[model samples]
Target: MKKLNCLIGAIIKDQNWAVIPFGNTILEPDDQVIIVTIPENASKIREMLEGGPVRTNHIMEE
Candidate 1:
């Protein structure tokens, strides 16, 4: 999530398991994730996460 300026704090899988996320973690199709980000970026991040088009040209270059 470095690209989106957010961190994935944890992931809950199948209503029975919770896993802390790491840089190399891979999310499953039905897994629920917890993301931590600033309020300013929430909508953009949501758009990206939901498979909507994001205008990367507007992203601030870190």
Candidate 2:
């Protein structure tokens, strides 16, 4: 999660039905994440999580 911000500047502002995120926070199957980011990065992050993990820190899956 820390890498998500440090690498792409997108922030996980808050999440529903989940714990407050820390550096090692792990997203579950049904967790609804709230993020603050630009539209392009939002799309990229969505694609990565929905599709699969990618090499870039900009898109972290799980």
* Candidate maximizing TM-score: 1
Residue 16 miss distance in model 2 (angstroms): 6.9
Query: For every model in order, what is the number of clashing pairs?
Result: 0, 0
4-47: candidate 2 lDDT, tens digit per residue: 33122222324323333434344444334555445656665565
Show model 2 residue runs off by greater than 4 Å: 1-25, 51-62
- Compute each candidate's TM-score over C-alphas: 0.44, 0.34
- Which residue pairs collide, candidate 2? none
Model 1: per-residue lDDT, tens digit, 1-62?
Answer: 32333544555555664654544454555546666555676676567667523222222322
Candidate 2 least-lDDT 10 residues: 1-10
| Alpha-carbon deviation at 11 in model 1, angstroms | 0.3
Which pairs clash in model 1? Answer: none
